[model samples]
Target: MIDMIQQFASCCRAAGLRISTSEILDCFRHLQLIDISDEMQFKTTLRTNFIKNYREQGKFDQLYHLFFHELRTDIEIARSTPLGSLVKDVLENLNQNPTDNPSKSILDFLSGDPIGFLEEIRSIQSEGNEPMQGPIKGPRSNLGSLARRLKIMLQIYAVQESIMNFLAENKSKVSWETNKNLKTYFSQRLDRARRYLHEDPPAYPDNSSHVTSYEKYLTQLGERNFASLTPKEVDEMRIVIAHWVRKLKDTIGLRYSRNNRGIIDVKQTLRDTMKYYGVPLKISYRKRPKRKGKIVTLCDVSGSVWSAARFMLNMLYSLQECFAKVRSFVFVAEMDEVTRIFENNDINEAIDKALKEANISYNADTDYGSAFRNFKRSYMDALNKKTTLIIIGDGRSNYTNPEEDIFDEMREKCRRVVWLNPEPKVFWYTGDSEMRTYEVYCHQIRVCGNLNQLMDFINDLVL
Candidate 1:
């Protein structure tokens, strides 16, 4: 029973739940006090020992369902006449073909050890998006994980077909009552596997609050995803953004004021003391410490997450004084410096010009792999230990190579990496999103689609 509990903890950890050794030990000690045959008490004991908070409970419950119910041993199915031998024969036939991951995982699911199937499901849910090989064709989708699930679903159907065919050929081998119960039990198990393919673990808040503490009036447009806003709403957003820029500036100024003052200048203090006949008079501090850190921004204006880039650019340039130098790059398939655009134009015009004439192929598919490669090849020198690299995107690389090595290299070259994903947290690992891939190297990941998220991020940065 303790071994079984430990195995369950292992499954939970594989599913991205943070189960610790101490928690498992606690679970072990607690289970000894409970009636193991009572399923509710058993589940409650495990849940109480492992799950720490409400947000994590959704994932915890899913893991529990997959572990206990879907993966339960089929002792009932095995006991009925020749059915056990029949199931073994069918599974042997299915395994005759060279098995891929989909086949292997489903086969594991049927044998009452759902660990392999659970692990595969976890991978699909957390799978990072990368480009699939082909032309820049029509409407593209990141269907790699989805496609794999469909294949497994077909395999499950095929197994049922094989079972039906076997029963027709050997009806005399098993009695009617045994056959009926056996088929029903296996059918229920297969249905459980089908449900696993469609199960959604949990989703974080999508369109949450628009009201920031600083905003006096409730902002209607602030809540909208930037890329989806209309022209009129865009104008309103600019007004709201101006206020944010000013507030960020004030906040930054306050930080510099409080933190950057240097050591006392003894020479200047003594010079002033002469006016008071050698008595200490006015004391003077040395100049403020140099704000020499660099901030490098890689904005994905891939049209999918367009609004985020415009406002993010507006914010970065407005608070340009916060850093010694600010470098901005925009990319879809390629990246190019757009600091000159902002340098020459007003904030609004610069943003418009960046979208229109930054020399990026706006029509091209987003290839984060290629973008990261280009950044490493061309602009790696711009990064230093004093640099903070901020990436703004949906992290959807259009099913292309993720090039996570380049990303990690850049991470090592900088003080920190911040990924501001405009996509809702729910959609992050879905489709072509490389959010999960890049998240490993990021110091922070924030949902930045709405103005509230943007405001919150800036508040963290400056306040």
Candidate 2:
């Protein structure tokens, strides 16, 4: 029972609970003070001993049931049966007569044929009894001690099996499906990926063939081509790459927009005042007025570029932490401002609303020309030298008129016209893609396929 309590405490600690030695000792003391005759009283004592917060009460209850709740029939039989003999029998039955019935559930095995199970448990106890050979008067049987130890062991086995079953049933809920060690590895990888996306980019391997000590095992996997890698390995690599890209973006802040007005440029301010060295500083300060900038994102949410659009939306959502004024627009055949949708806290809900508002269909063909023309006609006044315009799309017009005039007008009106194309540079003029024709009007044209490329493009924007 003492060992059982200690093990349960350990499990709670592993599950992010803060459990101290003092708490464990206090629990044991409380258990001794409480009457064991009443099950409810015993449970209350246990809860009072270990649980310090109401929030943790439910967690404690789960642990208690997992660790100490014995099979009712086992307890009844153990009370009457010779514990040593019963343990030996149970061990023999488990080893020699292991059940081959695949149809039986774990719960059934634990609860079914309780009398036979208890007898087998008692047999295991008997096998462990050793004769006393020291100053003891005679061979003494530590039957109660053996029984308690057996109980703890059984409880551990039951808990382990239960956890396995729970994991098997809930595998789909997890991001990665792998062995225990791999699952832990994937979780760490995910954490690293998220960190990279939001923080400064880390150094990449200088040499591809000369694998770093950290990823030596991964490099040794006999994979000659990226396509040949297993799905699990590919997913793992993708996560790592995604993290690297995210970190890169963090290191290189958005380049298109000017810094916020709240941030004072002491050096620039002082330089401007240098012309009035002998004059009043107030006059110079008045001459150099502070200016705020606006960020306008025009994302192509058409069927051709849905993946890239989703990624851009995610980045825009994350950018809310850095910027104050941000407006978003999604375009398929037409464009609609989705700033309010993005302003909502829930990203999934926001995206759904944005898609609905834009009437974006996954099957619809892209018409960047019409979308640009519509935006120019409806919101031309919104464009100014203070506004930074970011357009994310594949630059594919699906044989529609390129509408280069609208982009030309946009470049003249906006402070910057940045075009982010998901397709490679070679695909700019191929097929119905009008990227080559559209590229001439934009201040910067960047290839943004994956998160890394997108991060680099964003970094370049603020520069």
Candidate 3:
């Protein structure tokens, strides 16, 4: 029992759940007090002891489901049926030797110990890949593991082929219902794997440098996904965001302090020494580089991506005091500059006003090709070596021309282009998402769905 618990904990960590040795020990002690035979008590004991907060529960529950239910045998059924032994014997006999092939991992997955399969999927989700080489200007992330998953999916088909062949040769011994049940079991596991491969992982918050407000509700709202909030929570989020703006203002002040000046300005030093009769008693240095307030953002303000964009726009509004120029655009099928709207009103009111007044075609679908084309024609001049162009959207181009060439042009015009994807990494290349194509153009790409991600990105962006 102790060894089983330890192995389960290892799997959880592999799947990116932060479990500690102490939590594992505590879980062992608690299990002694509960009826381990009772599924409810067993699961509750593990979850309560290991999980820290509501936010982590999503991933904790997923791991628990995979470990306890998917991998284990039902007690009554195990006792009544000899099919378990029979199936094991047949699978082991048919299972091929470990070799360097995509089928290798699939075979391990089917051996009923999911650790290998879990590890493979975990690598995909967390982006275990080599860094990009050559003049490729963007990230080298495996791009939601689509290419890898495609291979694994093919391997699954190959395994299914083998399983069917085994069933055919041994049809006399295996009942039709037994064959159906075996196929069903394999299908279910494959389905689970598909979901893990394609769906979003939970938003795991970073508590390293935590921030909170006197209003507990507002703080909680800050932690929640912007899309999940209610109208009441939205109002509370604005209050919390205003607090963040004030904090950033202080950070900006400290950054511009004279004490933070750069390396000594030799030319300025020579000029100052001449003023002092070449005594050279005092020195002059370069002033801190002025804050580049030039912000060009192409925000997708339609569909679910809108929720995160609106909050980001609110934060940008607060930053107007820091930047000399802040230019923003809203887009769906086309784009429109909303800098005037931000300049004219309070940021909070400006958000609501921009949503209504901007030429954002809410009824139309998102088109990155169209949007970037517009940006190139009119707003490309807005970019320079001093500016940071931020693209805030899910990168879902609906199978249209991604126009990655235009992104190359934009990157040339700007110091850096940052892609802030609100969608989770697992869904990066799934469905209509052109994330794989768009990622090649970004100087940096990050998943920014909730407050912690947003806060961390802003901190790195400015300070």
Candidate 4:
């Protein structure tokens, strides 16, 4: 039990949680006072000792779940039994000639220890890209980390196939029940590994404490990251957002109406004074421009970013009258204009349809450069000096060309380029992210990881 706890602590540390030696010792000391078999008490004790702040809670929870539940290799079969021997034999055969660290680590994980596999994943997640040099003019991406991950995934697939083949060959030797258990065991392990590899790390809370009075109602769910929201939370979010949109529309309408008189025109006022025998009988106010603001948004709908983007689009369309026009495009690897979808259908229905029926491939690798290039080619005419180009994405281009040149051109063509990144500031420049490269061209860049931040951006846009 102590060994398992210690190993779990090590895994937590590897996953970027600050688990100190003193804390581990304190956790052990406290564990002696409680019944360790009580899972709730056990988890609470560990979390209380290890988690330093609210920001670390999400990461700590993920690590704890992974180590305790996902990585447990608890097969009911006894080692003396034929099923156990077959399991051991299969692992031994796969491990006889280990090809690489990742494969070896995977096999070790299946064999009941996941410390090495966890470390491998940590290394990949934390790998930094090399600095850009003279000619490229952008960050030089290193696909070495991505390649390593792909290799690990392929190794998992190979292991799964090998396990199935071994079971097929030995089906007659073992009972049907034993074969079924063995297959289920290995399948679960491999699938967990695959899921852990594919999933993005939980977003750390934003460190900046820019509190606003508007976020008073948004006590809990408003601060929660969009990607971390459950289905119920999402439904709650939609309700809150609908109320917010209505409030904003009323507020903007009143504000615009209050300012209908526009600014005083000094020359016009003086000219009218001359007509009144040099005594100002009346003052003249310049007419406010009748043209409304126009917005063009390029939203990245690839997995994680999509969670935030949909809400942003919903708000933009719900308050569509605030702008003369709101043209939206969704993209994964390629751009697809979904402006018509929103125009024809109800806001929520449009958002759902856009997600499902957009002409881009969601499964394709995220290539921001490709998407930007496609947009420039097909929709360059959509932008004018009156248009504000808002881009909602994490800026992860997957080591592809960022095509900053085209972005620069788009900047010149539009009134302003505002980027709303769902990722925290700390992760902006890491891995395959091209945020640093594209940052120069943006007129404004905000971390819109939660409802408050998104609401703040929309408020600024409308008012």
Candidate 5:
């Protein structure tokens, strides 16, 4: 029971609840006040003691069902019936086995009959006799032991079938129902599975520690090394990543400067104008119009860089509020402006459309030269001395023509050109990556991989 409590607490943590050993102890103390024999009383006591929020309550309910739900004895018996006999008989004759077999077997054993099948098997084993091969194990073993093992196997199969059915039925709603941590875990697992099936074989992690929470065990089904991570640890990672994403975008532009000589004080201007309004021939200085800032985002939505593209899109969407003008473009084979998508506040829809319109073949090929040339021709009028051209890509053009001249032309038009590459600087010149070719033309180039790197890059951009 103590182990069960601890397991429940761990599940709560995975569901984004913060639980400690002390809390589990407190729950035990509360359980003492309830009737131990009453299932409902025990459940009520735990819920009242442990769950404090709606989210925790939902998690508690799921854990409770998984732990307490038991299959009926009849169902267990039916499932444990020899698989070979069941399948052959049912498929060939389309007939059900006589239900009296189990009852008669139980009655014969209970009647103290010396002719019982189990007794006969034990007699043979006791005489060092080897039983013939069969689907069901020899009856020399205790029926109770066999039943327990068979029940566990059947339960596992049932749970797996349930999971598949749930996933198939709730494909769209799964995203909404599952928390971010679980989603990340599942997505990573699916990716690993695909990679294992199609690419290089994945190394399995050692499963030495048998004692782990259910969530951790589930994660291990996807990744062996991932078995040690608790739900709390996964949630912590999600929270940390979310914080970094917000911080990175916040730092990605020029800080508002109070000391800009170009910005006129309206109150001071009005005061100066009032002094000259009342009399003789006096001239008043005209107020200067604020200088509008220009922002040009060139993001790579190519197959190889989709993850980075998503993160960059999120950053740019946030930046739309701070900038005067944001011209967003996605590139693969060519560049297409997607500023309107951001304008409408439909980021997911916009990304879907952008991916379709860009027609960038995933992992196929990248033509930076063609993308830049197309951008220059289409949006040349929008480029000016005030414009900041921000390019986000891995810089892997598949050894295609980089067209450094287009970048030079872009540098001539924009105030500053900043290249944000997701790949590490070490890989900049490796393989077919063309980052080195275009790096020379950009005014600023930074490696923006994880959120920490991105935040540092953004801080530099703004400063």
Candidate 6:
């Protein structure tokens, strides 16, 4: 029982749940007080000792269900039953054929130990999105995992077929009941394996604040989530954003003018006094060097993230004169600079062209780590002390490595890094999101799920 608990804990850890050795000991201690035969009591005791946070309960429940219910068997039929020898014989025969050879993990699963197979699944699910490092580059996506899964599925099918063929050939040697039981047991185990491959783990519920107080404008659409917008609402939203852009431009100009007066430049004044023969006959007023704000925006154009990013990009370019230079980038698993798209075309036209023409793979999964690495490799020079780097995305890297070090480097190079997450604030740290990992490096993180939130951020940014 202790070994089983430890193994289950290992599985949970592999699936990205945080489990400690002390927790395992505590679980063992707790189990002694509960009736082990009572499934509910046993599960509750284990859950209490193992799970630390309410947010992690969903993952705990999934692993628990998978380990105790789906993977458990009533008896050790593979070793103790009379059919054990028959199963071994069949496996030996299957192994003899090189072309139909299954992966060692699959074979281990068939032989009754599923740990190897579970590890394979975990690895596949958590595979990194780092691109191939060579002269020749190719797009990266989830397809590699899918292909591996397909191969496993096919192998399972082959194993089932081989077992059926073996049973048919040796039917006379075993009783009818024995054959039926053998088929049913292997069938169930194989089916369980297939189901596990498809079962995506649930993400923790996001507990972030829904909305912040802002002056309400177009109350209905302004407050509505960007992901929930309809076609008509999106069109209406463009008009509203254009109006805001104009207002923001005027506001930026006014703010700049209000703060434009220079402080007394003592050195320049002293030099000018020398020209006046060291007398206070002529007074010289020093002129202020205009501060130019440069902005570099990296926007994730994947799925619903694009909904919020498009509007942000639109407003940024529409008020481009407010900034000395505005560079735009869009990314899915890879990033491409779209600054030129905006420069040569109208703001709306540029946005449309960026979506269609940017050298990015739209079908690939979101990989912020890869995008950051790519940016560092190609556009590291674009960042400077005067550049405000705004990253717009949901921060979901699909269980890939987040490469927070790269993000931290980015923060160092830029004036300030602001993350605008389109996902609800509650969902920022959930599932495959790398928000928490990258959050520490960001100057600010705002939940830009709606127009109001977006406006609030832009307002603060320019004014």
Q: Largest lDDT belongs to which candidate?
A: 4
Clashing pairs for model 5 are 14-231, 253-462, 254-462
Rank by lDDT, descending?
4, 6, 1, 3, 2, 5
Which segments of model 3 are wrong by more than 4 Å?
1-219, 262-286
lDDT values of the candidates?
0.79, 0.59, 0.77, 0.86, 0.57, 0.82
Error of 3 at 122 (Å): 59
User: What does candidate 2's lDDT look like per residue over 63-150, in tens digits?
Assistant: 4553465333344444565532333333333334334222122223232222232333334444445465678856557775466544
The superposed Cα distance between candidate 6 and the true structure at residue 354, in angstroms, equals: 1.0
TM-score of each: 0.52, 0.42, 0.49, 0.49, 0.42, 0.49
Q: For residues 137-190, write the lDDT of model 5, one tens digit per residue.
A: 663444544454344334333433333443455456434434343334333423
Question: All predictions: root-mean-square deviation over Cα?
Answer: 23.3, 21.8, 21.6, 25.6, 25.0, 25.2
- Comparing 4 and 6 on lDDT, the stronger one: 4
User: How far does residue 215 in candidate 6 sit from its true spot (Å)?
Assistant: 11
With candidate 4 superimposed using the best TM-score fit, by how many Å does residue 114's alpha carbon deviate from the native? 81
Q: Which 10-residue span in candidate 1 carries the lowest summed lDDT?
A: 205-214
Pitting candidate 3 against candidate 5, the one with the higher TM-score is 3
Q: Candidate 2: what lDDT? A: 0.59
Model 1 agreement with the true structure over 1-463: per-residue lDDT tens digits: 7766877888887776788999898888898899989989999999999887666678888878776765645533544546666666656655675542226667666765677777777777665344444777444364877887777789888767665666666678778876776578668878888887787767544322333533544365677887787888778777887877887777667777785668899999999998999998687889886465688999998875777988888877887787789889989989998889889999889988888798779999999999999988998998999998999998898899999999999999999899998888999989988888999999999999988788888767655
* Top-scoring candidate (TM-score): 1
Query: Model 6 clash tally?
Result: 2
Please say which candidate is ahead in TM-score: 3 or 6.
3
- Candidate 3 lDDT, tens digit per residue, 1-463? 8988888888777776778999998999999998999988998998887777766777878888766776665322334577666566556766542332335555555554566777777777656455666888456776557787787777777677676677777878878888787777667666766666666656677553353434565556667887898898778777777888799989888778847787898988887888779977777778877766577888898888888888888887677666667788988988899989888898778888777778767788789999989888988888998788999999888888988999899998888899999888999989999989978878899999988789888888767
